[model samples]
Target: MKSLFLAILLLTLYGCDNSQNQSKPPVKSENKEQLISPYFGFLNQQKDSLIALPMDQAMESPEKYNYVIIENQVSPLGFIQNKSDNKESNGRQTAQNFANSEGSLFTIKNEIKSGDFGMLVNQAFLSQYKIEPFTKVERETTPEVKEKLEKKYKRKISKSTTVAVLKDQAEFNLTVFENQQDSALAVFSYIKEDQLINLDFPATYDDISTWRVDDGGQFDNEAFQVLTVLRSEAGISFVSIFWGAEGYELNFYQPKKDKFTSAAQAYGYSSPL
Candidate 1:
């Protein structure tokens, strides 16, 4: 159910289509400007690294924070848009607040891969494909583990390219908007392009699940991979997986930290964390 667009082919040609695999166009080599988009998710996923955004503060009303961005604006929903009252934009409310108090209009164009993230990752990927904060990291792991993790992340992000890959380069635009007293909205047109991707692709959730997590006491099935760990001390800790499958994986270290939770990752990210 990919969104059909009039001339949307700016950069989405790289979407996985095994049947079209043979004739797939050459991977686009993007410049630093283009590579900046994928990091939009990093902002939301990494908000906890900020002391000001307490779990409680993060859950505050929509008008609170001030940054909103569209990182990889590939989808129709990703564009900043207002839903008409007449027909449903897949239930989009024409308005909705975002994590940082900036309201969101989720077109593949606006928020996630903002100029901030694109610039950062483009430079970082010069050395590696992904980047996370030193603060967000709990402790170090074996070089074997680190090496494996890097490979896994690179393989997964392969579906979305930039200066990082040969696929269509994705980019985002960040904007600041005040919260509106309105219902939740769909920022981008949602697609269930499930069948097109190979199940064995490392970026897929299944591959992430099997990536050998031994985060000391920080193990949670919900939070997987450095490329996608979402932490909110206030709500719940989670990581978005396999494109956009959902749910938070509550994490904590108990006495001796002997066991862990294995609940399936949440869908919709719909309910409260």
Candidate 2:
């Protein structure tokens, strides 16, 4: 049933005819700045990082953490299908519809880090085009394992660690919000010393008119090539989650508010560390 639904969705979004895999006109890049205008205030220009919005605070006011809308604006959800020919506007309304397609008006990314960290891999895919012969990682939280981790890292275990794995990539699932309906699926969380890194991606949609993707984990699924933490010599810190090879999204943390925020396609970020 899911396969059938996805197929129908692809047809509706793309077209009934594939034209033998014919390509469509490229989306306009001239308006990229305009499309991303809404997200200007949320970014941290001085640090070249997305504001590290606190998950707890964001949950306190979910409406303020509309990261998905920014994502939709920057990438334009339907841009992946690329069936439009506006050239000038590049399916602005369609992109907005795509943003709200699955009851998610917008989404937010949260970062949760702790020194004693682990992952649990439910499923993994090779890539978006080729998904087969996947890998599965079982969950384990035994005392002996914890002891081994403590001995290896030389740090006390704060919480049980579950290490999640992605095929030729890295991603994890952590739950920060008590209510599953209101919570975002945490992609990665780890602790290093006093630093507790928690990355959350929330799918908050406003409209469900377009085709919906059932899985909430779609954002982190093959969304990036590498995900790792980076700290500047000046004590400034951020996480660089890179897509493809060079493109990256910077997740930053603010101490005063005790929160987190992110920015896509950061300018100063040259290499992913």
Candidate 3:
């Protein structure tokens, strides 16, 4: 299965004869967005010019091309050489597995220059983990509930602050926390759904610094309700807030700013709970 996975991919993308001669500049009259539609066709058309270089090599001369076609799983580690026989054998297998899942292809335009491009790729490679989606069960935290929560939290809960819950349907107790700073934090804990037995995943904490709640417009500026909380099978979470007349803006809690497995995949969630 692994061999076939990559073999089919390579034959599809890399084995074809260079089709550069058949290529021509896009028609000037064509729509700009549609003109860029046949990016893969361009890849095959410029196959001869498209050097079969590693990512590092491509990064070095990123400006030479307008677009770069990369396999889904290309990593810098694949280019590294290991001297130890055992380590080399393991590395080779790991690299092969990485290459096997080449079901997708994408083109990265030269938006960032050499060093920045390399850094971007490195950051991406680090964040490629399987995410488990959480079930969104939105319940309004009323003023009375807020007062009760203050006793449990031991900190005076503000009337204006909003709160939401995400359950893993197992042994996880995930909650949101907002302080005087107006910054939100995702506090993690493990507890059974029915029994409420705390488990060993242990209580931990992380911040969703990327999401800035905009407090403006004619609506009650203090009322920042989490209108939506989206979870995916990949364990990713997204929160959408009704920021008054500013309407709604979607935000994700990224543990690492630079590392994202699939921004496109995350954006694919059309409906939220």
Candidate 4:
């Protein structure tokens, strides 16, 4: 009887160990590569040239394109690479020059020369990457909802500010700070079924010095503007543009499992003066 009791106790302990191991979450692999959506790309126009703002790893063969162009209402025009030096600065300068120019709209050319750089775009390269447009619904806040948000966020809601709701059901509330500065910052809040799920900027500068230098104390004037919404293979994404005194920044926000997060961002056009 003593030996049988000891055996049963050992088996019970082993079963408990197996159950604990099964209940614990699996270890995530460190070697896994981050996934990027194929539909992700920035749109900007310069004169007759449709520019795709340079984004990191935005293309499979980013080496081949000196420029990325968009024609008509298409999402991605194509990839163009400057064969001269294959330098990013050259590409940016080429884009900036086109952006600064003024001209009528035109179609994408296989090859074009802007400033000192000559770029070639492969029309077939981005054929697989396509995005569908998302609807932007403008909504007004009710008195009760406004008061609830103001009290919860500890910031006064702006009556004049517009609330934009994307097709994915994410809401953006642009609120003005009540301090003397009265900075016009966006309170990115999302409501699902009339319940606030998330509230915060899609992205923010980590360093105060970076914010000061990049924004140039233009917080009061800067506001979030919806550039476009895209539906890609990865999921739905919203692109927003913020123009400060120093330059303009584009932020891509996408829905994750439960909340929206910043996927990528690109800076463009600081005053040469």
Candidate 5:
């Protein structure tokens, strides 16, 4: 009887100890590096290298990458002529001159020869790393949100508004308001938990040239629109495109030290009307 009691007590103690160990939190791997998305890495590489490769390289070696930028949908930066020069010639002439310029990375011959200038990505890289894609949330602007924005900007909001949520960690709100001149001005704000932050555009109103005129001959309002949102385990990137009299501007914003700040910029010339 004494031996049986001792055995039962030992069994109970072992069970309790095993249960406690299982309930403990997982042990994170030491010095585990965060994963960056392949697409984001590719963009960063291009920006850093500043070396444009011929479009035929991807085609000559199709097995080298899973995806290749066959055509440049957006105008490559640094190829467009000065905005001042644009006024001297017709739009078609300016476009033709731009195409023929030696400095231009994209040319009519390149387009005809090999689609367009672009980069290629390897399938193995994508399979090794996983990144979340941005999902578009409803455009419904809540009264609380609207009130917060109105109070912050001290302006009446227009119906042109959009909201996007990223990785369930960040919320973005783009709102437009009419300035004193009755032109559309975009205001971008970010929300995380109880924090509300606004993005200060790097370019001032004075720096931007509004050359496009409306039917009424008034300067066209710039439409600052979000182009893409990329998420990686390391960080989140917000890419936006807007136009001015000069051409299209691409701005890259990323969160750093608790605020979304402009990290990089690219420019593309608009095809003249």
Candidate 6:
């Protein structure tokens, strides 16, 4: 189906509650590595406290109107507002997936976007969108076939001592560059697979780019090669779990790090990947 493309994902980490701590991700407990069970809970009293304040005042029955209006206040716009504040890059909404059928590559709608906590957003501002036929090829530049690619690209595109072209396969790279003017543009292929799928990109992605799918992510260090187990003092979720797959992080969420660690420890494969 057109909806079955395998979009890549990054990592997640724990965060602290706003009451005792605000705006900071949760810290990992020193003893947490020894405890990988998912029996945990936390609350962001800031959210609850907000709910209570209005309710308490409403219950007292104000002289004007005895009613509380608690709005979702999630700031759906906050997601894009953040990037606007950064003001260097624009966000693009992307829809991508992998299909077990043919012509699936044409379905990749890679958009450049950014994010903050709750959810990733796709902005319609000045963004670089991508589109092309999977069968189209300008050149090929693999070490094994550099000569062939050079010849192929020379005739179709620019002139280079060596050239490379994108096709409908899983071995490509996407690069987005923005200058001081905040004008952004991206160039990429119809396919590419990363060689080092690790476990720390999703969270990093939330802090930065939404278009940062699995293979397109950058790592802070080799530690990302393994699982990143952390706990959050922030809210309902207390644990964070990160797993490595295909040289990229598959996903990141809270309250599961301990469970994942325990499983790895039990299997005696807790070492870095």
Q: Which candidate is the best by lDDT?
A: 4
- lDDT of each model, Cα atoms only? 0.23, 0.30, 0.28, 0.46, 0.45, 0.21
Candidate 3 lDDT (Cα, 0 to 1): 0.28
TM per candidate: 0.20, 0.25, 0.23, 0.50, 0.45, 0.15
Clash totals for all candidate models: 36, 37, 5, 6, 0, 25
Candidate 2 lDDT, 137-176, residue by residue in tens: 4354355545544454444543443444434333232322
lDDT of 4 by residue, 40-103 (tens): 2322333334444454544355433433322213322334442232333433323444544322
- Sorting all predicted structures by TM-score, with the top scorer first, yields 4, 5, 2, 3, 1, 6
RMSD of each: 25.0, 24.4, 22.6, 12.6, 12.6, 28.8
Winner on lDDT between 3 and 4 is: 4
Per-residue lDDT of 197-239 in model 3, one digit per residue for the tens?
2111112222421233232211232333322222333333322
Task: Compose the digit string of candidate 6's lDDT tens values, residues 1-273.
Answer: 334432221111222233346656788867311211111111122222111111111222111111111111112121001011123312111111111111101110222122111111122210211122222123433443333333432322222111122243533222222222322233222123322111111122332433333423332222121122122342111112223222122122332321211211110011222
Error of 3 at 99 (Å): 34
Once fitted onto the true fold, the runs of candidate 6 whose alpha carbons sit more than 4 angstroms away are 1-141, 155-169, 174-187, 191-273
Q: Pick the candidate with the highest TM-score.
A: 4
* Deviation in Å, model 1, residue 146 alpha carbon: 12
lDDT over C-alpha atoms for residue 244 of model 2: 30
User: How would you encode candidate 5's per-residue C-alpha lDDT over 1-273 as one tens digit per residue?
Assistant: 999999999999999999999999999989643322222111211221111222211223222333322222222222222122334444321223432322213111122222212333344433432344455555756677778878876777764344667667577777655454534455577676666767643221332442232213222233565556555454555566555555555555666754577655544444556
> Candidate 1, residues 1-273: lDDT per residue as tens digits?
255563356345645454489777889988543322222222234322111111211222221222322222222222233222233223211112133232222322233432211111223222222221212222223344333333533321111210111122111111111112321111100011211111121111222332223222212322332122221222111122322223222111111121222222221222322
